[model samples]
Target: MWSGAAHVVDAMEKWPSSQEPTQTAYGLAHGTDLTFFEHLAGNETKAKHFSDSMTFMQSAPELRHDFVHEYDWSRHARGTVVDVGGSKGAIALKLAENYPNMKIIVQDRAEIITHGPRYANTNIEFQAHDLFTPQPVKGADVYFLRWILHDWPAR
Candidate 1:
């Protein structure tokens, strides 16, 4: 996180004269063309650390409570909710625990999906999906994209 923040600092320093104001911080930090996840993907340790960090963040009670109360999930009680990029299905599990009638599908990358069955609740299904491609599960009630967009450079 600190490294990413430092990258933001570096990116800001270069931002003033640049044509693209929202250039990626990771690109500036590493002086490379690869994005942050692309770099992490090539490094096993960093990828594991990143996954662990996300798990830690999702475990926070305040974050879970905010997610639960902020949305009107009752409207989709009988519908399917596809949580796109939902790593480990933490939010989906919480929603399943709260609403028995709703079916939640947590979709993430193949690496994450391999371990999904072990961690995910029985009520919450896990699927391997790349968010950049078209959504496989069609006509779902909600396609939740929680904390996913910030990874890319702003357009």
Candidate 2:
């Protein structure tokens, strides 16, 4: 996607206002109607890469060092955690590994959820949900929403 930086810059030339347009940089850069997630959901290989990337990124301590060390997740050891818009339960899996007593539910698009492990009868669960719609899971101890603002900044 970085290779199309110049193309996105050229597209910006058409509009130099402070207003937030409906079009995104990725959309303009690739000249496509679908967004990045949409494109990935339609392609199995790309979607796998997106989920794998999320998992691999967690290997970097700097990425979630604060969250793991700063936050006292032990407080919710026996509680439930709903990872809204979680991509293939990467973060959910990590949380479950630390707190085996806690139930971590990972929610995302059906296409993405399919790639996740079955996780049957375990602390880790999977659910297909649209983040834009009303959340089905209620009364959760914690609702984790990491890296969601960039995608749904307004809604």
Candidate 3:
């Protein structure tokens, strides 16, 4: 316990000492002090780390069944679809392969898109873009945003 003149402790010491905690501090400590969404939004390194962590998590069998079967690419013809936040061009490359006649634009953050070894296929094009702002590409028959919206909130 901290000795003081009956709740008249100095302004600096009125709060609990940082090293340990009183009951109130202990109770509050159990709750999260930081907003998880805000933290993830601001921390680019954390976002990239998380994205990379999920890199190998995609399985071919799963992609074939879940993604390929889920959509009918034949509906759209003779145009490009921009893949927003299309990291490493995985989905874009797959779409390009499936829809050989259609061009695929894989857009992602400058940090992710600027590095070496982007997609080599002529059908796929890579551009540095930030999704927080308005999209750059236009007039596409389709705009793909696979697994990207949830990264930020709906609002």
Q: What's the lDDT for all of these models?
A: 0.75, 0.77, 0.60
Return the TM-score for candidate 2, rounded to 2 decimals: 0.84
> Candidate 1 — number of clashing residue pairs?
0
| Cα lDDT tens digits for candidate 1, 4-109 | 5767766777665444423657666666666666676676666667766777787776654567778899999889999998887778877887888898988987
Off by over 4 Å in 3: 1-51, 60-65
Model 2 lowest lDDT segment of ten: 15-24
Q: Which ranges in model 1 have alpha carbons more than 4 Å from their true place?
A: 14-31, 61-65, 115-117
Error of 2 at 30 (Å): 3.0
Give a tens-digit lDDT track for model 3, residues 28-135.
Answer: 333323333233345577556545644544544564335655888777646878888777676776677777888888887665665513655558888988777887
Model 1, position 31, has a per-residue lDDT of 65
TM-score top scorer? 2
Regions more than 4 Å wrong, model 2: 3-6, 15-22, 119-121
Best of the two (1, 2) by lDDT: 2
Per-residue lDDT, model 1, residue 99, is: 85
